[model samples]
Target: MGEQRKVLVTGASRGIGRAICNRLHADGYAVVGIARTRPADLPEGMDFHCADLSSAEDLRGLLKKLAAQGPYHGLVNNVGLVQSDPLADVLLEDLHRAVALNLEAAILCAQALIGGMREAGFGRIVNISSRAALGKQSRTIYSATKAGVIGMTRTWALEFAAQGVTVNAVAPGPIATEFFWDANPDRDATTAKLLAAIPVGRIGEPDDVANAVAYLLDRRTGFVTGQTHFVCGGMTVGAA
Candidate 1:
C-alpha cells in the first residue's frame, strides 16, 4: 500500500463525510478529518483539523496548515448548510451563511489545496452536492450553491486533468441521516413523499453516497473527471 497516501475530508464528524473518511482510511489512506466542533471524535490514525467552514479566516488558516503538511492524494468537500425556512422567511444572514458555507468555503478550500495536488501530479477531489442542485425551486439559494459546486468540478477537471488531478461531484437525494429527520420531523409524511417519487422506494444511507465518492476519487477513475454522478435513489431521473 505504498501508493496509499493522505486524504482530507471536511465535515468529517458525521453522516456522509464520516463514512467517506472511514472508507478511505480502510482503503489504506491516512485520513485528515476536518470539523469545527467534532474533530476530537475522529478515529485513530485520522488526523484532525478544527475550523469553521463558514469563516473565511478560519478556512484560510486550516488550509495553510494542511498545505504545510505536503501533498494529499485526495480531498473531499462534504461541508454544507441550509436554513429550514421558506425562501421568504430566510434571513439575509442565513442566505449569506448558506452560500458562504456551501460554496465559498468549497472554492477556497479547493484553491488552497489544488496546487499541491497538481504538484504531486496525482490527485482526486470529490465534491458532495445535494439533489437540490439538480434544479431551482423553493430551495433555489441552497440549490444554487450546490449547483455551483458541480460547475466547479467540471471546470477544475479540465484545468487540472493534464496535471493528473481529476475533480468530480456526487449529488445525493434525501438521506436517512438523523440530522435530516430532525430537521424535518414530519417523518412519516416526508418518507412517504420521498419514496413515492423514487423508484428505489427507500431513503439513502451515508454509506451509499460514500461508496459513489470513493469510486470517482479512486486512482482507477482518473478517466472519470468532470462528471457528476447522481447518488439519489432514482430521484434525479423522476422515477419516484
Candidate 2:
C-alpha cells in the first residue's frame, strides 16, 4: 500500500473491536483503537484512546481530539451496551444507557468525522448491529437501538454516496466473546438452547466479525453501501 489509510475502531480493548484493529493494522491501515480503558496487549504501532462513549462530556472531548488528529479514512462503530430485560421489567435508565452508547455515540462519531471524509472524498463506515434487531426475547432496548443503527446506515449511505463514502452494518448473531460468556454462563440448558438455534452448530468468533468489518471498510467496497451483512451462521434465515 502507498500511504496507510487511517481508521478508528471503538470498543477496541478486546473481542470484536480488538480483532478489527489487529486485522486492519495487519492489512496496512493506521488503526486507532478507542475504548473506556487501555489494553495491555494492543498491537504494536496501533494508537489507543480511552473514552466512555456513553458520557456526552467524554464523547465531545474525545471527538474534538480525534478531529484534530484525523481526517481518518474509515470508522467502525463497535461500542454497544446491551441491557437484557423483559419489556415488563425494563428500566428507563437502562434504555437511556443503551441509546447513549449503542445509538447516539455512533451518530455523533460519524457526524464528527464525515466532514473530513467529504473533503477527502473517501471514507468508509461500518456499524456493528445485531441479529437480535430482527426480534429477540428480552432485547427490546437493544433491538430498537440497533434497528436505529441500520436506519442511520441507510440514510447516511444515501446522503454520502455522491461524496465517495459508504455506510453499512454488520449484524452478528451469537459470538463467543466475554460478554456472551458472561450472559450465558454455565453450559446448561440456556446455553444448549441457544446453541441449538444456530445453524452453524458453533458460536462465532471475534475474527469472524472483524473480517466482515474489514471487507466493508475496504476502499474498493464503495459500491456496496446501505446494506446489512449478517454474520450470523445462517441464524437470520432459520436454525438448521
Candidate 3:
C-alpha cells in the first residue's frame, strides 16, 4: 500500500470541522486538524495544531510549520466567524474579525499549502461557506465574507486547474451545532422559524456537511471543481 494522503482541516475542534476530520480519517486519510485550542474529544491518531487563525502573526507562523510538514493532499478551510448584527448597527470590529477569519484565513492557508499540491500534481480544497452568503437577515458581515469565499474558490479553481488542483465550496444551512443552540436557545422562536424554513423539515447535522466535504476530497473527484455544493436541507431551493 502507498502512504496515506494527508488532509488539513481548520476550525476542527468542534461542530462541522470535527465531523469532517472524523469522516476523512475513517475514509483512510491522515487528518491534521487546526483550531484556536485543542479539543478534549479529539480522536486518536489525528494530528492537532492550536493557533488562532484570526490573528495574522499566529496564522503565518502556523502556516510555516505546516508547510515544512509538507505534501498535504487536501485542505478544508472550515474556520469562520459569524457575527449577527443589523446593517445599521454593525460594528467595524465585527466586520474586520469576520473578514480575517472567514476570508483571509482560507486564502492564506490555501496559499501556504497549494505549492506542495502543485509540485505533487494533485490537490483538493474545500472551503466552508454558509447559506447566508446568498442573503440572510442579521448576517451582514457573515454573508459578505462567505460570498468572498465562493469567489476565491472559483478563482483558485481556474488558476490551479492546470496543476491538477480542484477548489470547491460547501455552503451549509442551519446545522444543529453548539453555536446554533447557543444563539437560539431551547428551540425558541428563532429556532422554530429556522426549522420551518427548511424544506427538509429538519435541522441539519454536522455530519451532513462532512459528507459533502468527503465527496469533494475523494481521489476520484478531481473532475468536480469550481462549484458550490449546498448542504442546506433543501433550504437553498427556496432561498436561491
For lDDT, the strongest prediction is 3
lDDT: which is higher, 1 or 2?
2
Residue range 148-184, candidate 1, lDDT tens digits:
8889889988999999998999988878776677655
* Number of residue pairs clashing in candidate 1, backbone atoms closer than 3 angstroms, sequence gap of 3 or more or interchain: 2
lDDT of 1: 0.81
In the order shown, the candidates' Cα RMSDs to the true structure are: 2.1, 1.8, 1.4
As for TM-score, the candidate ahead, 1 or 2, is 2
Kindly list the per-residue Cα lDDT of model 2 for residues 1-240, writing each as its tens digit.
233288989999988888899999998999988899999877789989988988878888888888777588899999998778889999899999899999889988998899988988899999999888888888899889998999999999999999999999999999989877776775779878988888878889999999999999988887899999999988888531
- The global C-alpha lDDT for each of the candidates, from Candidate 1 onward, is 0.81, 0.88, 0.90
- TM-score, predicted candidate 2 vs. hidden true structure: 0.95
Report the error of model 3 at residue 110, Å.
0.5
| Tens-digit lDDT track of model 3 for 85-173 | 78999999889888999988998899899999999899999999989899988889999999999999999999999999999999998
TM-score of each: 0.92, 0.95, 0.96
Instruction: State how far residue 26 of model 2 sits from its true place (Å).
Output: 1.0
Tell me how candidate 2 scores on lDDT: 0.88
Better of 1 and 3 by TM-score: 3
Model 1 clash pairs are 197-240, 198-240
Backbone clashes per model, in order? 2, 0, 0
**What lDDT score goes with residue 160 in model 1?**
93
